[model samples]
Target chain A: MAEVKTVQECASMVADGASVMVGGFLGVGAPLQMIDQLVANGTKELTLISVVGSYPGGGFDIGKLTAGKQVKKFIGAHIGTDPALVSGYNTGEIDVEFNPMGTFIERIRAAGAGLGAVVTPVGIGTEVEENASKQSFYGKDYLVFPPLGADFAIIKAKKADHYGNLCYDGTSMNTNTTMATAGKVVIAEVDEIVEVGTLAPNEIGTPGIFVDYIVKGFSTDERKAIFGEIWQKGNKLK
Target chain B: MNSREIIARRIAQEFNDGEVVNLGFGMPTMAANYIPNGINVILQTENGGLRFGGAPKAGEQNPDLGNAGGEPITMLPGGSAFDLAFSFCIIRGGHVDATVLGALEVDQNGNIANWKIPGKFVPGMGGGMDLLVGAKKVVAALAHTDKAGNSKVLKSCTLPLSAAGVVKRIITDKAVFNVSSKGLELIEIAPGLTEADVKAATEADYQVATNVKTMTF
Candidate 1:
């Protein structure tokens, strides 16, 4: 049976040197409180997979962990904003794996979907193929990215019922749904916790079966403000 | 007219009867408003949808349905959604005919500098790299100068480039320039603007276009 707990309690479930997957794109829908709790716990040698750059100007999330040297490896799409991760890579303090944004997300989804690998032509001849397995099929080269399963997946949702049915609005649906399904243990931090069956079935982005734990009663206003600004301004391609 | 409206009107004139194009954030998004009548251009968004016609109205925004920039956008008739991977396949695979993007700086070599500065807190390089690499033709629209009046058209960019040798043309408030292998070629001047005036505002070496003409207003 899944347990209901606080963000700090959920953070306690993570051990040192664990491989973790976090859901968010540049701080949107990230489990900020849980991340802070994990930082406070001071676990060492963690590997973090994230879609976003991570944290408040590099003061939070995987950025803070990377800054503290707790994160030993980072698998992310971009690190343009995280000074700690960028500088750490330059100084050889951290192992960084940079994948294309779309490919990175698909790798996580493949893990969730129980797929062994996903073949793509995106990084076939590029640096993205470095350290990745490659094969020739149908006279064309394809890069086979292995699924990235995690010991723990920390996700954030707008609201959840006691049964653990989750719903996210808009771009918030980026990676949380896949993370919920890919982790050995899934901990969801939600703004509201209501009675079971109150939320309509069609509205559930992640069903109750995928979630192993729930952390209730955390305010997500700060995260919303951070994400809203990025959504409004940062997405402009130019 | 406001600067945005003027830029929008200018972009609308670039479209033909039937073209498939992608619009980047800022001034490029404004192009949706300027699409001319009788032109049936399909607008492809990087986040995973394609629509034609125009921007969405207020209170009708869908979170799941958005452009690459995460803005709530409306879909035209026959609009469709795909995964982000397939959406980018359309970009990097050269299926996209053209892309209009905004820029912070554009250099003589057609390099784009829009993602970040040295120490700013911006979310850098969302999808600009893929668009630059894959688009058939790239068009940049930006202010003629920075807030401090420094030339944004530079000899070389001081910031990291989004793409090298990808920009085909640039349209700024002061003038229009075509990016060539050698360098920038002055093509059209904004109405009532002089060659010396445009040259003084740019830090790049430029040659007069053989067919230089006044930009359509």
Candidate 2:
């Protein structure tokens, strides 16, 4: 079972320089309320681990944090989507770490699953090789990446039971499920909160055990408006 | 057809029935429209969709189920949506048959440089490196030359490399070459192009195939 809290209450728990994992590919599965609260609270110098880059529009999704300079370092795949992130990185205002998409998620999973490290051939001879050690097994060299764990994970879900079992809709489940496991404290921002028995066993994407707190998120109409604004600008390719 | 379309058509022919193919963000996404009529290939989007259809017409966008580029897309009958973890599992676990991607530069050694530009706002490598490392065959599709009329096929890439020696084949606006251990082998040229024209346009040293001929669209 999980405690139900306000977005402000959840955001208040985070401290300066804390490492946070944000779930989303762009802004699809990001915790909208929590991110908004974090910005409103004026949190600073935090580290963010996420997938891909920021959302399509400026001051939207992770872009708000990037624009506010709330994030000191960003560890994820892709950063070209946001102009603020680009300028920040180019001017050395913010530190940036790049990871191959698959490796990024796997590293989070490794931390969640209590594994020591992840070994894969994704970056054998590239600059990714510089950060990780190379281990050759069975005549092929593989890069061994250390696991990544966060102090808090902020994620969005379609629905949540009072006990914190989550359900997601469509591809919006991108990084939420994985980040749910990797965070020391997991806060779920959900569109709907139903009774505990409402979510069937198979329908729950993330079980209650992994979730610590839940907050009501944008209503259907509000969410649709937000999605429209962000995705309409997603016309250009990166 | 335009040069990009021509390149896409040629790469589409490489598909086998039921093959699971991953297309990179830009030019490679165009290949989705040209899959051989009779082939039944499953398309995987790293953003969390499998068997997804091509870009949706205007006013048909669905925010919840977009591609890596955040464009609206549809799914085939048996297609399913999963999380990023599972989508990447199919990619990094060596299940994708082929991956088609665009490149900023590709060298004689088949190394590619498409991920980032030095001193530029790096859009971080999204999924190109994992696709190159895991796919059974990697094909790069792009214009043969840059805007300044410089050859994109090179002896060595000056831009930052995406992966070292990962390209298996390259289909450009001008030619198709197979990257082998020896070097690039010129196997097909565009219509109205001469061997001399290819040689002049290409900076990399390539062996002209004995069976070289104009590509049929």
Candidate 3:
């Protein structure tokens, strides 16, 4: 059984200079309260990894951390959404590493699965190949990428059982499922927490064995309003 | 219809029945509204979820059922959601039949430069590289020219490329082009536009197809 911790408690475990993986596409599936708590705690000089750079609009979700200058380095697939991160990157305040989103997630999965490396053809003919090692298989070229793991994984899900098993609401499962396995300390922030056996096995997105702690971040209504606010605030791409 | 809508409508005609397609941001996403009535095009949102329907009404939005760009959508009868890695596998593993994306530039050699610009801030390439390299076909959908009346079909792209020699076709507001070993082949021009008009707006050297037709929306 997994112990349910407060967002503060779990966030406190993330020390300064630690490497953290945040699961989200833009701001979807992000552990909002936990991120806010980390920002509030003034965690600094952190290595942050995310999928879409974070919420398109400024100072929301993981964008807050970037804006707060808590992150010293960012590894992400897209940074165009957040103006602060963009300026920070352009001005050299934050070091940013770019990868195609598929390679980013697959590298994390490789770490958790104990794979040494994965060779992919995605970056073969582009500047994305500049940093990686190259190899050929079956008469084709591919870039070899090692695994990327983090000290902490912070993710958001719709629901969780006492045992830390998680259920993602839908597309919110994006990077959250993979990061759960790659983080040395996996913390899941969910909207609801239920008793064990309340969540069926097949429906479980991330098994309890991979999750180290569960944090109830919001109620269903609260999450709804949060999403509504995101739309109302013009943070959406559409 | 406006040029963007027209471009999207034209791109919609490229899909065959039951083929899985992924749409990129901006103009490429609008193609969803124009898929032919008889065609059942499956949508693959890169974050997760497959074979989904179009967006919901503003008040009907479901946060969990949104695309990679955060637009709300509906899952069809056989639609299913998977985790991040598997969703990418469907993309990187070549299950996607076609991917339509907006290109900043398409060169004479059919390469696309979409993710980055010279000194401007832009989003990083999310799944573009994998989609370009893995999908069976890649379609570049954009306007024929930039806002300043400059041609985007170039002798060579000045910006960074998303991938080299991956775009199979180029659909713009002015024309439809088939990318080939012999460079861009002008196959279809927009209604009210002529072959000479396409040539004047294009910087890349290309040949007109023998059977050139006006694009049908």
**TM-score to true structure, per model:** 0.67, 0.95, 0.96
Backbone clash tally for model 1?
A: 3
lDDT of 1 by residue, B29-63 (tens): 77777676788888886655667333344333333
lDDT tens readout by residue for model 2, A1-238: 8999999999999998999999988777778889999999989999988886677545788888989999899899888888888888888888889999999999999999999999989987788888899999999999999999999999989899998999998788999999999999999999889998988899999998999999998975677666665555655212
The alpha-carbon root-mean-square deviation between model 3 and the true structure, to one decimal in Å, is: 1.8
User: Runs in model 2 with CA error above 4 Å?
Assistant: A233-238, B55-62
DockQ winner, 1 or 2: 2
Write one digit per residue (lDDT tens) for candidate 1, span A125-231: 33456757899889977778888789999987778887888887644566788778889999998877878878999888889899988887345554445444544
What TM-score does candidate 3 reach? 0.96
Predicted candidate 3 versus true structure: per-residue lDDT over A176-224, tens digit per residue: 9999999999999999999998998988999999999999897877776
Report the Cα lDDT for residue A147, model 2: 95
Superposed by TM-score, candidate 2 places the C-alpha of residue A99 at a distance from the truth, in angstroms, of: 0.7
Better of 1 and 2 by TM-score: 2
Model 2, B1-217: lDDT tens per residue?
8887888888878799999999876567777777778898888989898888765554554546667866567777888989988988999889999999999899989899888777763677889899998899999888999888899999999987888998999999899999989999999999889989988888999999999989886
Best model number under lDDT: 3
